[model samples]
Target chain A: DQQVKQNSPSLSVQEGRISILNCDYTNSMFDYFLWYKKYPAEGPTFLISISSIKDKNEDGRFTVFLNKSAKHLSLHIVPSQPGDSAVYFCAAPLDTGANSKLTFGKGITLSVRP
Target chain B: DAMVIQNPRYQVTQFGKPVTLSCSQTLNHNVMYWYQQKSSQAPKLLFHYYDKDFNNEADTPDNFQSRRPNTSFCFLDIRSPGLGDAAMYLCATSGTGDYGYTFGSGTRLTVV
Candidate 1:
């Protein structure tokens, strides 16, 4: 069973506008979450992350909001650029111990239009 | 620059043939991981090496094996490649399992 899920297969947004991507998970013990962006024929790059202890984290134009009680998280990019278009994946891990496996959600493809 | 590198970014192997994919990291991290991503699906972990200890995911096929001779490099061996095994293999490194892991460009395996 997939513990993490990104229901949206793809999304399109106009350039210089805000873009929002959503993700959900079922496991409560997972204390950490990360988002990675990938381009065609390239590896996924680390984007932004947030600890379960906090509700939000921001890095430049990107921000991640987490709702621990709802087991949900969302990634927001302000003034989205064409260069930001790619597949975004959300992943989570339980801890540094044996349950250390990272569960990933199916990626969401974002397209920026001019 | 510190990064993860995969050799022979692309590989073509015939059915029942054996192939090996290599990965090297200059990040000097303590944990390394292997993942298989099919088309648009999420990457699934195949195994990992924590320092000298090796850990394999329970669902990883027996046909697939991994070896980490040293901290700097790791290899994935496919015993008899099948058409269904064609996918992108990714190598990653992390300071700890709880943090964001850096991924390599990935090796695309094409089984003919």
Candidate 2:
């Protein structure tokens, strides 16, 4: 069973518009969630993270919302720029205590058109 | 700046041959991880070393092996590469926890 799920394989948004990427998880034990962005042939870089205690966390144009009750989280990129096009992944630590080994969702490819 | 470095960005090996992918980190983190990612799939954890302790995932194949000579270097050894083993191998490091987890650019492996 896939613990972390990114149901959408890809998303496309016009530049200057809002792009929303969604993720869901089967493991409610996960207390923290992270978002990562990867360019073609490059390693993924951390973008933002949200604690389960909070409903939302925002960083500049990027915002992450956690709905614990729904077992869902969404990453919102406002005024999405063409540079924002990349593969996005949602992840959570498998063992909340250790917080090292992560369970990742199949990434969503975001395409921001200029 | 501190970073994780992977050698031979691309590698090609014949089926049934042995291959090794190397990773080095300047972050001085205590934990190192190896992950395999196939096309459009999630990156799967193979094994990790926390200091000198090695932990292997139950699903990882016996053909996959890892070596951590010291704090700075880690290597992934594939004993007999199969066509199904073709994928991108990513190396990552973290401090005591996952907060500063950093990943290398990954080495794309092709088993012919």
Candidate 3:
């Protein structure tokens, strides 16, 4: 079963505009959420993360909003750049255990047009 | 710079042949993980090592095995590769606590 789901397979946005990627999970035990950006042929790079205790977390142009009630989270990029075009993956652990083994969504390919 | 490194960016192996992928980390983290990612799919956890202890996913096939002799190095051995086994293999490392994982570039495996 897919515990985490990214309903959107792809997204397109103009440069200097805002880009929003959404993810949802069915597991209630997941307390931490993370977003990772991946370029073609490269490993995923960590972007932003949010804990269950917080509703939102921001880092520079990237912001992650979490809603425990909905079991959903989103990544927002303000003034999106061409460099931001890549596959974005949302991940969370199965439970709040010591292993921290992550389960990832299918991922959304973000295209930022210059 | 301290990072996770995967050897052989690409590999082509014959069907039913044995192949091994190597990963080494300079981060000296306590945990190392192996992930398999098919085209346009998210990375799937295969196994991991917490220091000297190894943990395998329940669904991981018996054809796949892993070894971590020390903190710095890990290996993924495919006893008999199948066409369906072709995918990108990623290596990652992380320290205990609430830290994000560091992933290697990934090795693309192609079975012929």
Give the per-prediction TM-score of chain B. Answer: 0.96, 0.97, 0.97
> Clashes in model 1: which pairs?
none
lDDT score, residue B107, model 2?
97
Give the DockQ of candidate 3: 0.63
C-alpha RMSD of candidate 2: 0.9
**Local lDDT at B51 for model 1:** 91
lDDT digits (tens) for residues A24-100 of candidate 3? 99999888889999999899988888889999999999999998999999999998999999999999977685558
Give candidate 1 misplaced runs (Cα > 4 Å). A96-99, B96-98
**Between prediction 1 and prediction 3, which has the larger DockQ?**
3
Docking category for candidate 3?
medium
What does candidate 1's lDDT look like per residue over A1-114, in tens digits? 888999999999999999999999999988889999999999999899888889999999999999998999999999899999999999998564433667899999999998
The TM-scores of all predictions, comma-separated, are 0.96, 0.98, 0.97
* Ranked by DockQ, top first: 2, 3, 1
- Candidate 1, residues B1-112, lDDT tens digits: the string is 9999998799999999999999999988888899999987989999999998999999999999999999999999999999999999999988744477889999999998
Residue lDDT tens for model 3, B1-112: 9999999899999999999999999988999999999987878999999899999999999999999988999999999999999999999998877456889999999999
The best candidate in terms of lDDT: 2
Candidate 2: list runs displaced more than 4 Å: none
Query: Comparing 1 and 3 by TM-score, which wins?
Result: 3
Per-prediction DockQ, in order? 0.57, 0.64, 0.63
| Each model's total of backbone clashes | 0, 0, 0
